[model samples]
Target chain A: MIAGSALYQTAVELNRRAAICIPEDARLAVGQLCQRETHSLSRYVLEQIMENYQVAVAEQRPMCADTGLPRFYAKVGNEAVVEGGMVGLEEAVRRATAEATAAIPIRPNRVHPLSRKDQNNNVGVHAPTVDYSFEPGVNWLELTVVHKGGLFGGDYRMLFPADGVAGLKRFLLDSISEFFRRGMSCQPLVVGVGIGGTKDVCVRLAKEAACLRIVGDRNPDPDIATLEEELLELGNSTGFGVMGLPGDGAILDVHIEIAYTHTGGMPIAIQHFCFAHRRATARIGADNSIEYRGNPCWFTPFYRRESISFQPA
Target chain B: MNNLEDLKLREVRLRAPLTEDDIRSLEIGDVVFLDGVLFTGREGLYSQLFDLNLQPPVDIRSLSNVTFHCSPAVNELRPGEYHIPAVSATASFRFDKYIPLLFERYDVRVIIGKGGMQKEIYQSTFRKYGAVYLTTVGYGLGALYGRGIRSVKDVHWKEELGLAQAMWVLEVENLGPFLVECNAQGRSLFEMANAEINQRFEKLYAGLPQPKLKRLGEVTSPTCEVL
Candidate 1:
């Protein structure tokens, strides 16, 4: 059986891994861009970001100080048995978050919205938010932890059905430009676009796309995939290279996820994931042994040449 | 495409208790590697410095040269002993209101942060106090941390504002390779970049087909180049 204590330990381990590790894919993308960039300042910025990634990973320190809000995506099997009920599981995760905040020593970034008060620990109401999905006939638990709390980048908009594809392109470009003007959301950024859903659904999808999809992944639908590529090219052309400097590539990738929407309205959310791209996934087997990997594989049916490191505990 | 091919950048080394001449010698587009005592503070600390009118725990004139606009990730071992693990620059314009006051009251000759500041504030601060704005690398926390930071000398309001927002006193050696965004002469690289980029954006936006605005939602257009 999967014990609540084991789940707690898993959460802490996931947080630690997410803080320290910059996936090999992001490094490769930045490294490749550095070679192509002609602007001395842009190249220098990319080099510096790369160096930071390497040092942080080796030292097991956070790649960025804004070790953002801890968010988790969990896939639970209906067939799985737990040592304690769902409430017990939530309590374990919360305890683990406090432990990781101290152990990984991430800055306490949470505060009460109304009172403007901070606990000096990265815990608050509905924080370290978890999105759950149940899979039938499987007896394993899959949890993916994403560091989405960074204040660097995020924006959303709802459009009339008449806005169409051109609307998406315009809105997205404008949003990226606005973010660039406001000091940028720490580039080379991963852009996620959610189209054709309700406001909440599109925003959530965009966040998932930003935090979950690996760089270089494409949408399964050909038309959506084309839009993603077009947006990526356009965003990169903004000349807001690394740190709003000048460079060839501003965006690392653009992932678009879509769903059916009202005939009169189309909601689009444009979410930016900074270069940190910190995430980790773990699977707790029915036997209670945990296996871990770097990415959550949210956008499957895509290609990734980089290998995922699986550690068993 | 504002060809920076001919951008001549001066290389400089700055020490704390910087003088008017030291600030004057700098120009927009110059590069500086700073040496001396540096301190960290951000939005929360800015309120303490300006709104509250409360004195900082450390004598401002004693450190007296550079103040970084950042809230670093720190690990506190005890009451005073702390380990700075990661630090990155934040947007400067967020605290533009307090910046001029910082230069006026304190002997701060240079302010370090990322994403540059508004032209009016930079020009005013420079004209009045000969203070300059230097931009450190953004999103490169490890590189910033790797600089010759000696130790955390003191901290103010850790209990109230939390570690990131708390004011910190630090001693540094050759602590930067900062890009000069604004100089003591009141020239700003950010303003220059904006003008050039805006012109390019204008051209780019013009190339796109104009849409007919028939409804409230569709009418929202990209306001040109004024980030």
Candidate 2:
């Protein structure tokens, strides 16, 4: 079994560190998307991105909007057991959420779906945007941060009338093209395509797909993997490159996750995660020793980004 | 974003028994060059410091230091901008309570941050306690790098929230040249758009509820024991 308190502490420290480090590249890409002027300090998208970042930064908090529909993907082996052999994801997420909450000081961004009301921190009986559960394995506890911040500008239900796979592909490609041709002020957007029976699964899966890839990585499927390459070419062909370069290779590194379903109807779920994908951690050892990897950079930019004025409160 | 090499910042510690030069010389746009031993203590840290009633892990009262109004970053990715390992959870509201006490007990010179203080902080603390609050653009790294900050004075803010141990390197330069935000003074481009939409919203709605703050880092907690 792994240590608890102390181990949790160190991990918390690293999580924070990662959040700090990860958001910069994402912000820079925003600059590229907006095609910021080279010398105009205030005119560039970087300034607006920075302005957005500062709100999060000065507040000394996270900038990610969706915070993802979180699901703690885990694997608790036989080695780790609860006091009287009681165990589960509820216990894991609760314990882990508590440790992370204290360590990351994560603002309670969670909310209830039905009421559209915020839970703040109480993770009450109501469901959350994040779903943390179990995986049978061992090693005390190891956690990963996966968030698909909702930047739909509206709701996920707003879809283009699903007409199965063939028609749906047209709908999907068009949206990707619109995002690219229009020149996104937000870039390095992780696009996840979820294909399966139900809409919720595909949508949830799509958001989760973003977490599947590391910052500088790609997708894992073969057939859809080919589609990813094609989508990548189409997006890059639009002349929207890394950071919005006319010559950038790919506008998006697309990832597709799929599950089998009946032949009658096909549902596609698409989730767009901002480039500022953020995550935090806390590792505790058996000795009550804690190493906290709180928020990292690159998650939400703060320092000298392109600035934008705010509306009067 | 300028390269890390391009960004320059200076760090200095704080001291008490205010001198005329320290008080008068400080103004709206002057850049500071500081270096020496200083420590961090917002409300939380301040309480801890008062309770501890001794030189804690870090040194305070040493004029040899400058306290940044902005949060310290973990590392530098570029000039003016750096990798902030943790989000420094400092809200002026929280620290205002302890500033007077901090100045009274310790020698603090420069405080760096956005919207430092109003007449209340200045009249009571700056004038009475021989202290002044400096405004580093409301929210951005440009101010940190503006004028010219060279580097960290030493290991600092090791105890505050948001990546306590991560190193934040500050640089100095022309921040105004790099960023211009939509602020109270009505400078941000965003304000223009938001205002237009708001006008329409106001007409269509009444008795609207206030918008709440949204943030990330909400759920990094371990996944549930079961799905």
- Per model, state how many residue pairs clash: 1, 129
Over A48-147, each residue of candidate 2 has an lDDT whose tens digit, in order, gives 4455465455645444322334434332333444322223334444455444544444434454445434434325453222333332232343345454
Model 1 bad stretches (over 4 Å): A149-152, A299-313, B8-11, B140-143, B207-227
Among all windows of ten consecutive residues in candidate 1 chain A, which has the lowest summed lDDT? A302-311
User: Which candidate ranks first by TM-score, i.e. highest?
Assistant: 1
Best by DockQ: 1
Top lDDT prediction, candidate number: 1
lDDT of 1 by residue, B1-227 (tens): 24554467667888865777888888766778766678888888888878998888778877767888877767778867877767667777778888878877887778888777877776677667878888876554643564456678888887777777888888777766678888787777666655645555554465453444344533244534333
**Once model 1 is optimally superposed onto the true structure by TM-score, how far is the C-alpha of residue A251 displaced, in angstroms?**
0.4
